[model samples]
Target: MVEIAAWLRARQAEGTLRELVDLDHLGHGRVRLADTEGPALLDFSSNDYLALSEHPALIAAATEALQRYGTGAGAARLMSGNFPVHQELERAVAALKGQEAALLFGSGYSANVGIIAALMGRDDVIFTDRLNHASIYDGCRLAGAGIARFRHNDLNHLEELLASQPVKGTRLIVVESVYSMDGDRAPLHELVALKERYGCLLMVDEAHATGVFGANGGGVIEEAGVASGVDLAMGTFGKALGSYGAYVAASRRMIDFLVNRARSFIFSTALPPAVAAASLAAVQLIQQEPGLRQELHQRVALFKGYLRQAGFAGDLGPSQIIPLRLGSSATAVAAAERLRAHGLFVPAVRPPTVPEGTARLRLSITRHLGEAELAAAAAALVACCLR
Candidate 1:
């Protein structure tokens, strides 16, 4: 207990102690701090890139399912909890990812960890990106396999590790299609070639890219024309889809194997029928409305252009996520406060969310915000962090 307290004190000294803030959503990219009737602040910290969470289509689907199916699934999926909406959503996900089959999990983190644990085992060696999500690392630990972590997005480094490790068991390589924090995309073509050369299974976590890329929102894999080369396509409905749950799209055999072997899926209750239905609606909506993705990119371009014009060239990527590293936790927190002072509520992302010296504010471009809001956010960022 003393050690725990000391650790917390250390975090406090570093200005990294975390706390949750209650917020009231005001729609159209505005939020107010709850309990005090605070002024509406431009919400630039949400992951709802396409802002479909509050769409009428999604809401109506969820409402219908709720009225028909009640509140919960009542049991684990392997038992009696599975609903028709589950299968329907899985089919939609499989089609979206261009795979023969798919299986749903409670969340993106669970899907990732469960997928890794079920596939690679004691004799296997998995090569993963150094900066891959924590769930991937947890999955590696659960699998009890030989783990090789290469530098983030460095194919040469990954190849070096792959070549050095002697061939043994089922070799797998995992990476995110679009990094959650950095927002940079993976080199799918090169990774596919390397996978072919090494005879390794390749998995791409398309959580961030799923609803924001490709003509039909199939993510970076489809955008790069390497969907067939990827062995497993993992993604979530919670982000741009604006619903809850995650899924993995793969061959029929692989998904069947997960159905039988993935412990997370086997042990957890199925997602509520309404959430699954909402997710299905979100998927169909994204496919039918390509304008949503296009409009989001236009917002990205507009915001990034503003930053460029303001002469702040730290870390601006093509995707919706952007970071402005401030090197100190206190500095990042101060920046967030300054932005909030200007009626923009971008959160300060400090360690351990980022590296020790890479603390910054993560700004997510969403369709909820209009051109006026985007311009105001850009101006605030420049005033808060740049100058």
Candidate 2:
């Protein structure tokens, strides 16, 4: 215990320790932190891209479910915890993603780690993008597979690694559709082609892209017209869909396999009925309401244009996520403070979340904010950078 205390103290001294701060979510892209009382700021750090978390339909669904099914899932899914809402949500998700079946998980992290661990083993070889979510890396490590990381979004490097290495028992390639920190998309088409050439399984995590892309919010896989090419497509309902839980959309056989083999899914209690109901509502709304997706894209364009006009140089790619690079942890924190002072709430992402010396403010655009709020946020960010 003393050694643990000393290590924690050392981390705090190095400015690497993290502590959670309470925040009051006032609707429409506004939040007030516990330290402050009166004014709520325009938040650019949220993953609620469509602002559906507080939608009336989702709220109503959750309320109805809570009244009907009580609070907790008493046991794991393999036991007596599986409810009607759970199956309904899975069916809806599978249809949305154009998959034959879908399996729900407690969270995106659980889905990633569970899927990888269930499929790969010590003899298998896993190739992952260097910038994939930490959950994917954790899964690889836990599986005890031979892991190789390719340069971020570099298909050439991936192919080189594949060519240099001999055929292993099972080769799995993992990547994210849109990187959470950088907001850049992976080359899914190229990756699919490579997977075909090498006869390896491909997995694409669409956590950041789902509910924001495609005609029906099926995500990048559907948008690219390569849904059939990829083997496993994983996504989360907590981001653009503005709900909780995660899922892996795959063929019927794959879903069945995961139901039996994935330890995380097998051991964890099922999501509460209310959460499943709310997520299902969110998914239905995302399909029915194309206007929300359109508005989000327009806002992203407007915000990016404003930043460019203000002399911002970083590219945010085609996604709604934008990063304001600040170089050092101290500078990023200071910049966040400046933004907060101007009634803007942006998080400063430091080392481990981002690469060393590339600490940045990750700004996520949502449809809740209109042009005026976006202008203010852009100006505040520009001022912080200039200062």
Candidate 3:
């Protein structure tokens, strides 16, 4: 116990230990809903890129589902809670992705963990992006596969790594369609070509791209025209769909194997029927409501254009996620504080979530922010940065 406390203290001293902040019951989008420290703020820290979290259509669906199915799933999926709504959503997801089958998970984290750990083993080699999400990294570790990293978005490095490594076993390449932190894109076609050349299985995490990328918001894979070639695709409903839970789109054989073997799926309580129902409604919206996706694309373009015009140069990837590099952790936190003071609520992303010396402000744009709100945010950020 003494050694553990000392280690924690050392970590803090080294600026490597994380400190959590109480967000104080905030709403989604660019507004902090509630707080004890000061006034309510306009939120820009949300991952709800489509602002569907509070959409009337989704809310209506959820409310109706609640009346029909109640709150909890009551048991694990393999047990009593294999709700019909779950099967409906899975089928909808599969059709939307043009896949043979889809399997649902309680969260994106679990889907990645269960899929990777179940599919790969000590006899496999996993080639992951250097900036892949923690969940993917954790999954690879848990799978006990030999791991190697290609530079972020660098297909050349990935190919070189694949060719140079003398490691044996099945090769798996993992990447995020749109990286969560950097708001950059992976070179999907080039990576897919590499996989074909090397005979490797490719997995894509569409957590941040779902509902904002593809024609039907199938995510980066669809946008890149490689949806058919992807071996496994992971997505979440909590972001653009304005609902909760996640699913994997893959072959029927893979789904069956996961249903029977993935410990995370079998051991955990199934997603509540209400959540599945709401997600089904959300998917229907994605299919039928072209206006929402259009509006979201416009929002992303407007924000990125504003950032570029402001000379706030950064990666500014082709997706909604944006990051403003502030260099030091203290500076990033201070910038968020300044934004909050100006009635904005952007979160400061620090170490552990990001690597050292790369702390910055993560700006998540949504369809909810009108022109006035965006202009105001731009002005506030300009003021803060200029100061």
* lDDT for residue 185 in candidate 2, whole number 0-100: 92
**Candidate 1: tens digits of C-alpha lDDT, residues 187-250:** 8999999999999999999999999999899999888888899999999999999999999999
Worst 10 residues of 3 by lDDT: 26-35
**Candidate 2 Cα outliers beyond 4 Å, as residue runs:** none
Q: lDDT (CA) for every model shown? A: 0.91, 0.90, 0.84
Off by over 4 Å in 1: none
Q: Model 3 over residues 1-387: C-alpha lDDT tens digits?
A: 479989999877765566665666445443434446476677787777777777778888878888988998899988999988899999999887768899999999999999999989998899999999998999999999899888888888888989987757889999998899998888889888889999999998888887888888888788778977888988999888888899999999989999988889999999988888889988988888878889978877887777667666556767777888787887887788778779888888888888889889888888878877787787778778634
Candidate 2 lDDT over residue span 61-119, tens digit each: 99999999899888999999999999999999889888899999999999999999999
On lDDT, the stronger of 2 and 3 is: 2
Model 3: which residue pairs collide?
27-33, 30-42, 30-43, 30-44, 31-42, 31-43
Off by over 4 Å in 3: 1-4, 7-20, 23-37, 313-315
Clash-forming residue pairs, model 1: none
lDDT leaderboard ranking: 1, 2, 3
Model 1, CA-based lDDT = 0.91
Cα misplacement distance, residue 223 of candidate 1 (Å)? 0.8
Kindly indicate the candidate among 1 and 3 with the higher TM-score.
Answer: 1
Measured against the true structure, the TM-scores of the candidates, in listed sequence, are 0.98, 0.97, 0.94
